[model samples]
Target: MAGEITETGELYSPYVGLVYTFNLIVGTGALTMPKAFAAAGWLVSLVLLVFLGFMSFVTTTFVVEAMAAANAQLRWRRLQNPKEEEDDDSSTASDSDVLQDNYGQAEKLPILSVQRRGSPNLFEITDRVEMGQMASMFFNKVGVNLFYFCIIIYLYGDLAIYAAAVPFSLMQVTCSAASNDSCLVEADSKYNDTDVCWGPVRRVDAYRLYLAVFTLLLGPFTFFDVQKTKYLQILTSLMRWVAFATMIVLALGRIGRGHGEGHPPLADLSGVRNLFGVCVYSFMCQHSLPSLLTPVASKRHLTRLVLLDYALVLTFYSLLSFTAIFCFRGDSLLDMYTLNFARCDVVGLAAVRLFLGLFPVFTISTNFPIIAVTLRNNWKALFHREGGTYPWAVDRVVFPAMALVPPVLVAFCTHDLESLVGITGAYAGTGIQYVIPAFLVYHCRRDTQLALGPGALNKHRSPFHHTFWVASVLLWALFCCFFVTANIVLSETQL
Candidate 1:
């Protein structure tokens, strides 16, 4: 009741803004980045990576800020439809006590259409509000929600890779308990049955089963609502920090163990290129936009925020890659920080092992919620009714169900870890990180009014600046379309 209101009378916060930005940008990709590095080769990949990061940062900065500005300047009527306006007029029985100038009665309701129930339906209040209208709206726009499904598929693929190899790695360690040969080596191979010991259960199906288990895990996760998954958000954040720490320690361990070029043969340009794509995908947390704007810093503060964010991300990525190259060279590099650290007997092994062992649990926890929410919201919007508002409850019911359904239907589609990474690289990678923001940038850059903050109606700018932005917009659009198409084709062909 006492917060800053937008033109539509919605509350805005700066805390949510920062959280949304940070969360949107980080995820499971952090765990798999090493694998990407292994494929791309450090030298060639790093250069391209730095450039990509810079482009993404700049583009994202311009687009998100501009959207905030545009939303602010629009009149309340422009934001919502006639149905919403009518709903507002009927509700808000407290209109007689208009104490706040910021409060716009007509704009209080969102740009949504609800079902016409009984007369009481117009004013019925429930403890839990339905917010699925937007979800339904989203699907209508994006065709089949394939992009959202892709995330669940990717996560399932990761689980499959882990299941296929982790147990085998453990078996090797137990069999050769006293030997120096790494248990992980046997598991890392594309082929599963290289028996270092006489009695190790090495078979092709074993690896296949591992892949199947992972896929099975993934199916259910994709079936639910993304907005409702709270545990997923927490676990992912925890995993991020854990992955970051483990990567550094593992690199040091590899270095200490005398692994040298400091990288494996497979960690080439192809591998690193793949990793770059994964990093971009994992770090994307755009869904947290509502939460990120919870804080209230001035428009002038955004430049500093962008600068700090880029610096932190770039520094972490560069150091992590360098450490990876320094510690494991050639075909010996691991796919994840956990895989790397699992080979060592260092003090950090306890934390690393726990993370590795429990990661699948945490990973599967969120995938379903994300998918269901996205779908549910899209469904509501398309139907022109209110969707479920509480994402957490929706996720609780939907996440597990989604997780279980996929594997049952597909017989747990199996894929290798690297193959999974490649799929994501070709699909979600190009669209979410590179394409969407680029399109938004191109669309918004022409109007200088967009460049100004929410108070743009009162701001001033030169006509020449608008021309400059127009040229800039065209350049970026061309680049985005070209690269998106290229990346898509190249990824599938592995070119």
Candidate 2:
């Protein structure tokens, strides 16, 4: 991909990028949100959800702003050493011919072109830098390692959740007692490991069996390079929209027919811990912003496009969760909201029930290998030296195993998707979502100004450019950490 494409009519427009970003953020978290919302109570959930969404948006701009800074930094280094310019960086803009090779050898020029308030802007965002590369650029070795640790932990939690959920859905739908069309079983929340799935097999055994199949099927992709086929993304996107629409309409339809069973409290502090994590998990799109935003040919209105996407996502989450908590009782809600409708009675049509039951299978099955591959690559990156290559065995076997084993082990131990999301989002998600970006933007700002002189402006800088916002983000992350730790300690003590 071209590193810099400031002019229009190139790859894709900002509008298309908006849709891709929306899809990225609105994944598994949305499916798990209603249960958290119900437990937390509507008033508290709504207020926290809105605040979390706003904070997420703020950090998203930080990611974008950092991306532009990464570009500028790469471009400056390239101009300094034109020979080794394209060695690691991609900011080899064709405009390097503007100055002679020894131009800045004696007395330095502006690291990047100087930008005086209304002078024609020349400090173009000339490269696409991944977050890891950005961390390496701005952070010390310890900070870089911390960033990788947070990301790896978050992805592991994601894989474990997926590993548990797909099989759990299969276990729910295939149980002979539950699946028989003759019996009108209500979507019950009392399911457990001891429940009978088939004549002799218990639900727990069936779940493990399906988990084995899922691992055998998708786990191999971690060992090889898996490029997401265009058709696969399209198919999954279609099924996802269909699944979400069906759930929302079914919930709305049930509430309309005087079958509404929900009566959640307006405020409840007991569930706030899970609710905060759920909201953070739901609004996550910061890490992948580089891949999504870089290919957009024109970034003039990129921030506006992102704003529109977040607004739409916030509205959609509110609709999905609000309808959900009101249409189903808090006590009866499942960890996976979609599972609540995976029954003949809840959804009138047999086809719809089948589709809803297998929705995670379709969408998440496709996503597993991609995430596995990504995690595997990240593990390799964390250990890589400046001029080093791993042996074939370590590269192929060790890295993939490192990526695949821990999450599977976690899944084997527990299928509690709620706690999995809560723990992951509250801690690792805090670093990636709040802490990392705040520090990245803050450091990148200092580095950029030092290089380009104070007058050098990054046109794509975040609106929350003030130092106060960065400090506030850091403080909020600290509060979440303390609050979640206290709750966990209290619960354990009680137990």
Candidate 3:
């Protein structure tokens, strides 16, 4: 389970944790946000985005609190079972020995009574409890399975979005180049797969070909353990910074020159549903909390650290979206904003235009295999039996195959990036980002009360500790589901 404390050395400062969290929360979702803002109206989008960022920050606290509780519980169980400690020589004995010694001194103490005493060191965030591990600790079989199901769905959506995005970008740039040397900056100029890119080859065929090439190039990495090297991450981070800075500066310059053509409505009710989904997706970091928080050297200001990160991210999102909406007309903004600057005229330099156009291609291609392997490992963990080993073929091939196929097929059927992002974020992203953390915190608090007695205090408890906050998060998630579903149904009927 991912939530169990592993002995990975803590090497990062809190600042590094802040950087990682920032990077994790801002990804492909952020790129789609300006278009969402354009559609929803900037004022409405601003209010909703801030509210969503706060909600995400609240849930992140919930996850970290649960993580501390999970660690305390694991330590308590080990203290109660001294014989198991004696049997496992490879275990880290010093910490367990100190805990056992404390328990032995108060031999007549009730189980976990030491924790109930509110020992300052008892609930330390030393252990790495993955989200799945925390689910297993606090949830029953049914609840645990639900957790896995939500996560699996979210990861699948993530893969599908990545699969579609790269090929779509490639097709857009290739077709635009083949059709004319001049860039297509006009709002009404849209291309489809049925449009010709080369001699007798439609854009749709070209998309499939690119998708195939993408799969062929990156798919095999899923079969092996894919570790993202430090250099690779650093390189991608640099590209990300360059691409984002260029877009923002370009948009701001256009707006400053008074050439802005945008006149987005004050409120577009039709776009509100998708805007909610995009915001949820953009602020998501809850699923990766355990991995992110575990390596931090200190926990004293963990919540404050998270708060600052979200503050910076929200400001960045606002600046990016506002500039975009003011610079480009709502109808002209592409789903991927980088494409708007891909024109040689818009950007002037061919190299810069090419870089902007291929930005998604460079970043998403790196992520595809890593995400695919993660999905594969999650599948193995979900159905895994105690002390059971999978067959060679099943372990090596079957899981990776299952993880890679469906998303590619989805990419084949449609390249509607906005709809894909909206639907995925609305449903599974809602589950992982909002519902799961709320429930995990609720259950963890209850379990802590039962084990450590009502008087026990968890040092890492969230600032939003009231029961009302838990109910509020769940209620918000429920409302989002109903709202998104109604919008889908109404759209279908109108169609």
TM-score (all chains, Cα) for each model: 0.62, 0.91, 0.92
Query: Compared to the true structure, candidate 1 yields what TM-score?
Result: 0.62
Please, what are the lDDT tens digits per residue for candidate 3 over residues 83-161?
7635532333432222121110011112244435445465888866667767767777788778888888888999999
Off by over 4 Å in 1: 1-20, 73-75, 78-190, 193-232, 253-276, 294-300, 345-354, 357-361, 372-414, 441-495
- Clash totals in order: 75, 0, 5
CA error at residue 212 for candidate 3, angstroms? 0.8
Clashing pairs in 3: 2-130, 3-129, 3-130, 5-128, 193-204
Sliding window of 10 residues with minimal summed lDDT for model 1: 123-132
Listed per candidate, the RMSD to the true structure in angstroms reads 9.9, 5.8, 5.8
Model 2: how far is 221 from its true place, Å? 1.2
lDDT of each: 0.44, 0.79, 0.82
- lDDT per residue for candidate 1 within 249-317, as digits (tens), equals 766765777754453453354354355456555545432332343233443355456556666776777
Off by over 4 Å in 2: 1-10, 89-123, 176-179, 183-185
Candidates 1 and 3 compared by lDDT, better number: 3
